[model samples]
Target: MPAEQQHCSEKSAVTNSSTHLPVRAEWLATHSEMALDPALPVIDSHHHLYDRPGSRYLFDDLLCDIRDGHNVRATVIVQARSMLRADVPAHLQPLGETEFANGVAAMSASGIYGDARVCAGIVGFADLTLGDAIRPVLERHISLAGGPIDTGGRFRGVRQSLTWDADASLTNPLYPTTQSMMDEPLFRRGFAHLAPLGLSFEAWVFFHQLSRVAGLARAFPQTQIVLNHCGGVLGIAAYANRQAEVFTHWKLGLQELADCPNVMVKLSGLGMRLGGFAFSDRERAPSSDELADAWRPWIDTCIDTFGPDRCMYGSNFPVDKGSYGYGIGLNALKRLTAEYSRDDRANIFWRSAQTFYRLPESSMVMSSSNR
Candidate 1:
């Protein structure tokens, strides 16, 4: 609750054993037996892989996960703070994440990762406050992704988080709370730079902020914008008796976002807190149905508003992994979308992400026949 400790300390101490420890193939294989395939190619539009000294999200683990996971051909690797070295300048503080992706790209060149490659469409950071400076910041991010460390070279966009909320339960206070960046012209000037480069914009805002998101989408029709985490709905103790009121507000806000053509949504990352699913010792995991119930309305609404062509699946991994395994969250998505036609399912699962991230259909090292 203190300002110094704003981040939720769910799994704070990720021991070396927890990092590099192999997720037994037998366990996943056995779990796979209960999993149903919608027979679609899925591009998890938003997942995070952090690096610890003895961790497995390194190149070897990433490739192995892709090979063992469902029909994934190409994926867009987003920035996490794995490479945030202390010596980098404050303006360039975010570039460390971009550098980490480049490292993933280099290892990708070894040609062992089956058909799924770390498609180079990176969404690094640019401070919207430094209007003119943002352009170069973006340019530097792309350059970093294209450097020798990155063999895949998929630089695509950036995600400047604008989630500022006064409600303590709704956000991590140490990080800036819920403020809509789109409402500010200075930030908009920085945002305007992405259209010409074919780069997309990723947005992280709370449900109350969706109206402003709709406004941003209208202002920048050409700049593709992706909304993360179902507009970040939160289930606070204050709303225990009145869940519907918050959800009602969220539903209406989402409708406004659906009005924007350039804005797409990623149906992930609500299970931990917003969904009111509790897990203490890793044995009391939430079921797929529970996860699906919390998100189905929002996901279905986004699909109806933007259609399946704009909808994409994302794992929100490591974060969600604390509550459920990678395969579990993904299986919940499959279950949530089971009612749709095969073609529609394919679009939501992969085709949309392929076109969105500009990932190649074929791989030079590994063969991705699923696409």
Candidate 2:
């Protein structure tokens, strides 16, 4: 069995709401390595900043990671039920997240945060199952994110999490989802609004569900879809002791999803307990090399199938923090792609995210050490 990993177990009295396996800061500190390429610019394509009942990872927590040593110049904040509005109608509540993220963007834009432009692009959440009623909600989100989409809105897109599974442990009951959630007519109708608004979509489905994502991509080729967490690899519960089977299914899914020209993938999240790394089982936090070795088979396959142009790196932080530190997590990514051409590496590092999210020009500045 994989190392018992915890995530957002809010129901657990001893643990925080935001952390699954509470990160052992002291254990992680036992081994550390500086950024592999300090000058190589990066845009952390996907990260969440949520303040749950027992957990809090706000702007300050993220800044600490940014200060850890990577040359991350900009970031795209993905939605995670963060800073939601309590006063608004149920459907209109997501707008508060956009407002919160954009406010953070404004703070980073002020230059006081130094080189990093936090939340340069924001991906807010809205239940697409709401169908056309979601249009007004999306408009309000766009408004909160700052401006018009074609003219470069900081609001990049929408992510209605589709992660689901038969095993109870593999899924999150907090967000009720189904195997056919993607195929629902009402969901499709709401999703249709994205392309017209010039907005992109982020899919956070599991490996077994990647084929469904492929179908959705083909159904809406005009809309840009970015697959999250390396297509949501599974390692616990029914997926345990079956790495070979899981990898085979995952590879086939990757190939099928890659056939959709409209879809892209993020090379992140393998550090999570769901990924079955079981690094947490060790007496100490795993080193970057260990992470790189365990992750290479998965991350390498993503780049191989999707190519650099359609691939970007995301920290998937705080969630994966249970397995490794921010710097170490990124170092594993850097080490995995150490042999790629500089331009290709840049795509995985920052360019692809900037392109996909329509991030600002400030994030495009490449440092002299970008070799």
Which candidate should be chosen as best, given lDDT against the real structure? Answer: 2
The segments of candidate 1 whose C-alpha lies over 4 angstroms from its true place after superposition are 1-33, 52-57, 60-69, 147-152, 177-180, 279-283, 363-371
**What C-alpha lDDT does candidate 1 achieve relative to the native structure?**
0.65
Please, what is the whole-model Cα lDDT of each candidate in the order they appear?
0.65, 0.83
Pairs of residues at least 3 apart in sequence or in different chains that clash in candidate 2: 6-20, 6-21, 7-20
Model 2 global lDDT (CA atoms, 0 to 1): 0.83
Q: Which ten residues in a row have the lowest lDDT in candidate 2?
A: 1-10
Per-residue lDDT over 1-371 for candidate 2, one digit per residue giving the tens place of the 0 to 100 score: 00112222111112243315666665666666767898788899988887776667777778777676678889889988777789878777888889999999899888887878999899999899989999988888898887885665699899988988887666666677999999999999999999988889999999999999999999999999999999998888788899999999999999999999999999888867777778878898888999988988899999999999999989987777777778888898899999999899989998899889887676555555553
Error of 2 at 254 (Å): 0.6
Clashes of each: 13, 3
Deviation in Å, model 2, residue 203 alpha carbon: 0.5
Candidate 1 vs. true structure, TM-score = 0.82
Q: What are the models' TM-scores? A: 0.82, 0.93
- Return the lDDT, model 1, position 255: 82
